[model samples]
Structure formats: C-alpha cells, structure tokens
Target chain A: MANDKSSMQLVANGILKENPIFRLALSMCPAVGISTTVMNGFMLGVAVLFVQVCSSLTISMVKKVIHPRIRIPTYTLTIATWVTVIDMVLAAYMPEAYAKMGIFVKLIVAFAIITMRLEMFACKEPVGASFWDGLGMGLGFMIGMMTIGLVRELLGSGAILGYDVLGFKPLLFFILPSAGFFVVGLMMAFFNYIELYYKRKKGFKS
Target chain B: MKNIITIIIRLTLSCLLAAFVMGIFFVMTSKAKKHNEHVNEEKVMYSLLGYKVGAPVPETVKLYAVYRYIVTDPAGKSIGYLVPTGQGAETGFSFIILDLDGKLIEQKPVTVTADDAAEAESRDKAIKAALGAGKEAVYADDKTIIVTDNGARTAYLLSGKFAGFKASISVMLALKTDFGIRGLAIVEHEEDPGLGAEIEKGYFKNQFIGKSFATLKTLDVVKEPLPDAYAKAMEGVKGEDGGKILEQYKDHAIYALTGATISSRAVTNGVKGTVAKFAYRINILDNVLKEQHIVVPF
Candidate 1:
C-alpha cells in the first residue's frame, strides 16, 4: 500500500487527508490540556515530533524480529526509551526550554498518536516511508496544537506568545479546559468544511 | 512449542538491546545532568539572595550551606542534631553534636569520602557508621542557607514545601537578619496554568516580601480583590517604589488568586510555617554556637 504513493504523498496524506488531530482525532488530550499558550503548544509539538519520528523509525527497522504476540510491548518499550533519552538530553542541553517542556516530554509516551502510527503504519511500511509518515503526522499534530493555542491565548489572556496583543482579555472563558473541547470541535469542522469545499470543486460526489 | 521458544528468545533479545541502549545514554548524560542541576540550584540560591540572573555575583557575597541532620536513636526518638561547622576548605569535616536542649554533646570528625558523597545511601552509611551502632543521623527536612555580603550577615534562606492545589509546591524564602522576608522563589509546583500557576507570577509572590515574622504569623488568604494600584506596582515597578507599595499592604491578608484560593492559601501558610520553624531552629543553633564559643566560619 505504501508503494502506491510517493514519499512526499505519504507525508501530505498524514498532514491533510488523515491529519492526526483534526481528522483521526488521535491524542486529543494534550491538544486540549497543554494548548493554553502558543509556547506550550510549540514545545510539546517539538517533543512529540522527535519522539514519533525516532520510535517509528525504530519500529520499522525491528518489525521483522518483533514477535506478533509481543509487538505491542516492543513498540511501547521503544517509545518509552526514546522519550527518556530525549528528556535527559533536553534537561542537560536546553535547560530553559526543558523547564517549560519537562512534564509534557514525559507525557509523550502515553500519547496514542505515537503508538498508533507504529502499529498501523510503521510495522508494515518500509523504513523511509515510515519516517516520512511520522514526520507528517508529527507536523500535523504540531500545527493543530499551535492553532488551538493561538486562539485560546489570544482570546483568553489577550496575548500571543506571551506578548500582549489585545491589551485586555476579551474572553477569559477561552482559557478554561471546557473551552478546549469547543475549540477542537470548531477546528475539526473548519477542516472538514475546507475538505468538502475542495471535493465539490473537483466535481467529486459527497 | 518450537515457534513459542523462538518468539521468547527474540523478545528477550530485544528487551536486552533496549536496556543496553538506555544504559549507554544514561552513562553519557548523567554527569552533564548533575552539573546542570548544581548550576540551576546555584542560580536559585543567588536569586533568593536578590542577585539578578545574568549579572555576576559580587566577590563580597558568599553563601554558606549548613547541613542539619536529626540524629535519631534506633527507636526513632530524636536525640540531637549533627551540624557541620566551618566553610569551604576551612571545614575540618567535623560535626558538632547537640542534644535537643541545645547542649553540645561532642565534636567528632566524620570522614565522608569524595565518592561516598556522590550517593545518598553511601553517604548516609558513612555518617551512620561514625555515629556507631544503633544511632542514625537522618538528614533534616529543610535546607538552611546563610547569605553573607562582605563580612556581615545579610540574609538567611530556607527551603520548604507544602501541598498546593494539585501537588506539593517547593519554595525557597529569603529573610533579613531580623527575620523580615526579603523575597521568595517558587522552586517547583504542579498547579494548573492560568489559574493556580499564577502563584509563580511576580504580583502574587512579591506580596510575601517585606512581611515581618510578626505579620506572617497571622497572615491569611483573603478573597478580597487585589488593589489595582498595588497589582500594577508589583508587576511593573521595582526597587524602592515597589517596596513602598508592598509595605502599604504589609498588614493586609494575601489576595487570593481569582480561581485559585486554595493555592494562594497553601503558599501563604507554607511561608508562615517555614519562617516560624526556621526562627525556632536558628535560635537553638545560635545558643548552642555561643555556648560552644565556636565562631561559624561563614
């Protein structure tokens, strides 16, 4: 199935056609929980991106050796190992960024997005194809998180990336966790609307 | 059976490989991680002493860490405290043992090797061995820091922790020689962002500054809104003007965060308890030092 599409197409598929956040709706917890500020969203996005790519690549490489019965455990172990290594590296080299992203970095292990990719795409795809798929999905999640964070931070705190843009909070309700569901739902609908618009423009059936 | 055996071997081999890879990274990063932690702690200490980050600490400013241990009998009854005396290399690595009543029991030299000091278990073992059988010196619950500028005592810093909205919040508070608060830094917490997390904001933390031990004893968290003037001053103004605004509210209760009164109260009560305990402990330490006629090297 991967051979039917070029590597670039695979990446685009992950970003648009099967976007992890808005379309597949994988890992919605972090998308809502940590998307209070753009900086948080960006930091967590980078962490997830790194972990996803590394774990996907590792799983694809070792797919043959992993027993079918134990593949799930192996994938979990691989993801956890990468997360720990990345966590330590960030703590040592990027202390300031680490201070902000430390807790979220550890939380990446529990993100269904990374594990789902390994099981569904990486286990069957070639190494290079798996890498591109991971990148695409990671980028998709990052963009989704940043978009949510931008809206929430702007409306909730009247700030963008911590700089005051509106000078006063116009809608403090946007910062609450309940606002997260509304934002995600609206974003999903917006993406679907765009997709439907393009499909109809192409003269495709609904 | 044959297929099962092969699968088990593969799983075992993969697990071993994962462990091996993790072990290499752990070794490569452990030293750098330790160094980073040490530097971060030094930064916290300097900040607590009112030294701004990025500016070099002046040569005249010195910090002395006094490690206090509660020496307990085998039955867990607290018998005394083992406090190290002197500073830097001047330390003969000797500990002055004082009973609960602040009477000096003995001054004994305990050798803590360089390697043993790196690990807590080994270090505890060495200290325990020196104390002989049936006596254990458990480390104190809080940190005691003495800040000196030139030859004069400038401040005393203490670290304490208390339950906040989600988890325990660790804070390091600086106090003037007379026990008035100088500043406070929230070292770590798990409070929610945009709400309980606002406790770390300057406007909230600065409220604790300039509050005397007397004021702290009765300090409470009030639901009353923070005065707009004081809030603006706390967030923007620094130096003398900010001090005046904080002083004006010195007698007032802490202004609770709009949706985080629990966190606000937690920090206020935590600071109050920390100061009260530090005052009592320091008083005992001072009397014991005077009675022993041993000039503290810091």
Candidate 2:
C-alpha cells in the first residue's frame, strides 16, 4: 500500500521479511501437523503456494464487484476451490505422499494466509501485484516450514528430505507436539537474531 | 432499491463464481482422490490379513467399507460368518475381521471399549505411568504370565487370543518385552506431566518379561490359588533379570493382579475370554478336520 512494492521485493520479503510461519506466523495448521518430515513439509508448502496464488489472482480480479459484507465468503469459496483441486490431484497421483500429509492437504481452506492476502493486499491491488504478493508469502511459508521440518527431521529422525544425514541417534521427544514448540521457538529466535544483525549493520528496513 | 440490488448482485456473483471454480476443481481431482483412498484401504487390509490374502488382491475389494459374508468349508457348506467390525476411541479406531460360528463367537472378546468411565480413567493413568518411566520397549515375559500394575489400577494377561483385542485388557499383551514396558495406550492410572504421563519412559510394564502366571502366584506380590501343574508347565521361562523364575512359570495357569486385583482380573478374564472364544472355534474346526481326515495347520 505504501510504495506499491515491486514483484522482486515482494518475493524477497516472503523469503525473509514477512515469512508466514517465522515472521507473521500465519497458516499454522499444516505447519504443525506436517512438519514431521522434510518431504511432507515441502509438499504441503507447495500446495499452499498453489492455493494462495490462485485465490489471490481471483480475489484481485473480482475485487471491484465484491461487496464488503460478502467479500469474506467470496474469498473462502475461491480458496476452497483451489484446495479441493490440489487435494484431489495429490490423492490421485501421489497416494503415498497424500497419506503422509493426510487431512492437512484439505485444511488449506482455513489457512489464514490465503484469505489474509486477499483482504489486506490483493483486494486493493492490481492483479500482477496481488499475484506476486501471494507467491512471495507462499514461498515464505515454505521456507519457514522447511526450516522447522529440516531441524526436526534431522534431530528427531536423523534424516533430511528422507535421506539419512548426520546419523545421530534421534531424541525421540523432538518428534512429539511438546517438542514442536521448542523447535519453532528456537527457529524464530534464530530468525530474529539474524534479522537484528542485518538491521543493525546494514540499516535494512523493508 | 438500487443499493440493495447492488448488494444482492455482488453476493450472487461471488457465490456463483465460487461454485463454478469448486465444480471444476472437483472434476479435475476426483479420480486421483478416489485412487488415494483406495490405496489406503488396501494398505490397511494388507496389514490385517496378508497370509490369507491370495497373491493379488481383487480390484473389487473395497477396503474402506466393512462387509459381512458367510465363510464356507471347502465342501461348500457354510461354517461361519466373516464379520468386519470396527471400534473407535477418541484417538482412533481399528477394524477387525472376525470369523464366527454361533456360541463360540459370542464368548470371544472383540476388543470393545469400556462403557464405564472409572475403568477408562484409571487405565489411561496406568499407561501414562509405565510409559513415563522411560520404559517403552516391552517383550514377551512368558506364556500365561500375569502382569499387575499397582499404578495402572488394572491388570493384564499375556498370551492366547486375548492378545488380539485393543483396550485396557490389551496392556498385558501389548508389552514390548525388548523395552520392558506396556504400550502407553493400554495402561491406566498414569499421572499428568509426571513420570507416569511420559509414554516413552517404559518401566513397570516392562518388568513382566521374565515373570509368568505361576511365578506371580508364588511371589510375595500375590497370593492366589493356581494349579501346581500349571506352575510346573511354566517353570522354565525366565524373567529379564536372567533366571529360571520366569521360564519355569511361563505357561502356568492364570495369574492374578494383587493390589488392583479387579483391574488385573479384568485383563486376565478378558484375555481368557478371547482365547476361549478362539480356541472353541478352532477346536470345532479341528474336529471337522479330523472327521474329514484332512491335515492342515491349526
């Protein structure tokens, strides 16, 4: 809204500045459930990205016609359409992955990030800008999810992306829900530290 | 009127748009989603009865749905009904396919949940306690062993058809002997956020590996009447600490839980009930086999 941020900036911001899980912490449902494995985390991230991008474009194109009272439902309908499509496609072609991801694939309908972008950015923006914003945010979510999943998988399971790495005896506790909080907190703290260092040294403000 | 018309038009347009997109989406993904569901059902089926499953599963078998059919002998006479029953708890449910012939099936324990709340709560607590003590691994302690959990407020029996069902009664058989603990789901009387709640701790339930029904009856922990013949039969099995104590009584008669005797007895009875049910049917089948002079694995 301030500078009509360019597509490149939006993309970079999603990766670092306004990350869905690490920075803004939006779309947590799948983040918690599918972060058990790196492959699951990546697959879920891509699914979210697909839904987010499609919903954003649709919402932007119809922004002028949608009334305020009906806008929320309109956006949800759009998101759910994309989610069902992705869910069905995954289930058909990649049954094993679909099983591993389970209900989280269908849960993208309620992922706040999709609707949030539609309301806060896409509704007021042009189609191109809205598309970029959605893409960036989705990628940011992917990054955050992948980071957490990588750490958890590596420590809790001694694997990364289904490949055995480090071969450390897993701390079984890390795989459970309680350890989820611990892993996410440490990652967020680490992100904050990096952000602070960059800001202090380079005067970075995006 | 114009303002109202605009609102109505906007609402209608959005709804229509949503429906259109959703319809297209469904059309595109329907086949794949159905396929995925089919595969999952197949996986569950494979886990349940692979040995009996002919080399290739028939494409027509719908894994998600439970169907009842009659099981017939090779001679084409009906022997029993194959009933697929599913039971659910708060966490999840399991589907069990049972073959039943009359009174024998009625006596069989089909892994039912507790209708009573008190038993459920205590059983849950016990599971938590045993798991919290870093005892997740369990092994076969001995045949006909009696495992009593003072903390669990329940008891369990290991061996026989009783091992097939899931519930508090399952605590005794679910024990991972290698780890020396009962699985977290079966134990009752576990504490919250304490040693008991740690499902991974693996302690009290693990102690049963070397002990047996005969050993339990003779120990200071319990005082119950068990046949000496049963004791003699179980005398050779050893407990984890490495002694003939467990082996000697591995296959002894029934073992009883002492402090939480009711819970223990329930598990024992539940197991015995399960075995009786299965054995009765098997025996009937055995008799049939003998009459036919047919040799097959029982």
Candidate 3:
C-alpha cells in the first residue's frame, strides 16, 4: 500500500531484504533445528507453508472485525488454531510425511515468522495480498532451510536427502547444534554481502 | 461503555467464526483420518511379524478405540491385538497375539468376552502392575506399534519414550520372544544431530539388533573408553543370536554410541525398563488367561 509494489517484489523481499531467516532473523529455532537434513527441512517447510498461508488468509478476512486492542491475542488464537488443524489434518491424511515431522509440527506454534506476518502484513492487507505475502515468506523460509540443510547434510553426513552423494562423511561438525549457528551466520553474512555489493553498484549509477 | 461493548462483540464474533471453520475441517477429516492412521500400523505389524518384503497383505481387525487387530495371511488362522494401556507404569500399550487356542505367541489380541468382561475390567489393574505403576504415556499410536508372526510371536515390538540429552526420544523396539532385540528404530528425537542423534543411524541401532537379553529387568549402559578388542569383537557379533553376546556385553550392557553416551543411556534404560515391565505384564496376563478354567472363581 505504501509504494504500490508489484507482487513479485513482495515475493523477492521475503527472499532477500525481508527474509525471515536472513534479514528479519525470525524463526531461528526451527531454522537451526530441522536443517540437519534436507528431508527434515522439507517436511517442516511444507508444514509451515500450509499454516502460514491459511492463517494469513483467515487473519486478513477477520482484521476488520477484530478489535485493535486485542488483535495480538486474536492473531495468536488464529495461528495456534491453524497449527492444530494442520497437525491433525496431516496425521489424519498424510501419514508418511507426517512421520518425518513428528514433534516439529507442534513446534510450529512457536515460530515468530508466522506470527510476524499475521501482525505486519495480514492485518492491513486484503486477503489476496496477504495470501501472496504468506506464500513469499513461506518460500523464503523453505529456501533458507534447504540451503542450510543441503550444506549441513552434505558436509556433516556426506549425504543429501539421505542419498550418499559423497563417498564418506566430510565435516561432521556441520551437523551439530553448535555448527548449526555457524552455518546460518555465515550464510546470512554471504547474502548480506551480495545485497551490499548490489546496492553500491546501484548508487554509483545514481 | 459503548467501546467496551464493541470489543466484546468483536472477540466473540472472531471466536465463533474460528469455531465454525474448525468444526468444518474436523468433520471433514474425521473419517479419512481414522483410515489413514492404520496404514503405518499395518506396515509396522507386518514387518515385526517377519513377513518378508512383498508378503501378502494381512487382514486387520479394529475393535473400538482401545484395541487393534491383524489377521495373518491364512484367514482366521491367527490374531494380533494392539492393547492400549491408559493405566500402569509407562501408560502406553502392548501388542499381544494369541493362537486360535489363546496361547501367547509373540503379541496376541484377546477378546473381552461377556463371561470375562468383569474380569477384563480388572485386566487393566493386573496389566498395569506389569508396566509397574504411575508411568505416564509417552509414545503415541503413530509413534510405534508391535507385531508377531501369525504362528508364534517372534518378537515383542516395543515403542517407548527416552529422556535424551536434549528432548524426549521416541523409539520402536523389536524384541524377540527370547528377549533378543530384532530391531530398533529411533522414530522421533531432538538430540544433538552429529553426536546424540546419531543413535538413529544404523551403526548404533544395529548393535542391539539380534542380541539376546540376559535380563529385561535392567541393562548396563557401557561407558566410553571401551577397549579396542572388545569393541571390534562386539561388531563381529552384530546380529548374532544367543546368550554369548549377552555374556560378553556384561549384563546386557549396551555400549554407548561413541560420543553420544547420554543419548545412548537414555534409550538403553528406557527400552530395558519398558521391556521388563511388558514381559511381566505378559506373565500376569498369562496367569489370568490360564485361570479361565475357574470361570471367574478368583
């Protein structure tokens, strides 16, 4: 609404400037926890995607009717309810993937990125716009997770998605919790460097 | 006053709308959910029963919410029951299967007959004593299930929760009727990945597989700094049968998974306690089943 940005820019913002992982640094708990394997990250990412989109759409529709003074609670109620629904629905239907994301499903309620979108974007935007924002954020999260997962799994376990890509284990440290933070920080810095480099180039033209 | 009234109305409306949407989803999924849940259970049962890959689909029995059943390849030839335990220590479940004659093979499914319905009521208390008392349920149905061969229970499929170094670890344990561990699957866990979580991998879990149980009552978690010869000797005996491994391993002590000693001990202790309690429960149930001659005299 402020700049009348295109839908694609909104999507790009989640991946680059407003990335829940890199820029905003939200949902770091899961960002580190599940990135141990691509399979783990993929399953959790899908769960987050489903919850993120649904909650955004619902919150957008109800924003007007909801009291501003109580909007935060309302948003929480909406997100938690959606999370339970996703957990049950997955358990009830998709038994295979649900197996991969056992306890992580319940942990989604604690994700700050999911709630932040509901508060910042979904609250003010129309349902359609909010839906796009949710998709963008979810995709960004998925990319971040996969990037971390790919690096950790490949380096730590010498595998990717359980496939033995390397003949043997490379750097075992990458898979540990301590290395989890290291890899994420390095990736965040790498992405930031790219952003800065591009910005300086753009400034030179101006 | 007017503002407060508007606030109340807004909150109430949102709550109602949320309720309405949730109800629709709940009703939509209720039936399919039940059907899908039994799918994983079906696979786990078959595997534990030693039906090799590509075995024919086993016939299944569903008795209300508390019990699960699977009729093996030959129809009506054998039955397996998933006993849901909401009482006793561990407060999970045990898979009991019986031959047509009601003998405990591996795991059996016994019916609650009208004549023994009253006695069956006491079965919970009796069975609870097997798992000990006051244990909370940790593993859910989806977390684990047990299966035995149609002819005889080849193994006791055990699923229990282990308090790992980080989070609770849910594991499926397959123990042969002879107290040998057939398999161990770390289904869900939150341990440190490269170290503690390696318990999920083959090298660690495979060590316990096919190793006989000296006593289910307790297992020693072999601390690190293991002698080289002992470690290599242990690997050579992986999946080897008999009490030799039990003796060599010292009171059925499970060697800690390399640098993940705490996580290793958690699984070792949890599985040991659960199996011992379950074995005792089966013993109690055996006595109770044997007394059918009295027809409720005791």
Question: How far does residue B32 in candidate 2 sit from its true spot (Å)?
Answer: 3.7
Backbone clashes under 3 angstroms, per model: 0, 55, 8
Which candidate leads the pack in TM-score? 1
**Can you tell me the CAPRI class of model 3?**
medium
Model 3 sits at a Cα RMSD from the real structure of: 9.8
Q: What is the alpha-carbon interface RMSD for each candidate?
A: 1.5, 5.2, 2.3
Greater DockQ among 1 and 2 belongs to 1
Candidate 3 Cα outliers beyond 4 Å, as residue runs: A1-3, A203-206, B57-162, B170-177, B183-189, B215-255, B284-298
For candidate 1, lDDT tens digit of each residue in A33-143? 889999889888888999999999999998888889888889989999999988888888888778766888898989999999999999999999999999998888888
Interface C-alpha RMSD, model 3: 2.3
DockQ each candidate and list the results. Answer: 0.62, 0.28, 0.54
The better candidate by lDDT, 1 or 3, is: 1
TM-score of chain A of 2: 0.93
Ranking by lDDT: 1, 3, 2
TM-score of chain B of each: 0.89, 0.30, 0.57
What DockQ does candidate 1 have relative to the true complex? 0.62
Q: How do the residues B49-117 of candidate 1 rate in per-residue lDDT, one tens digit apiece?
A: 777889988898866655677776754444344344565566544556777666677766667754454
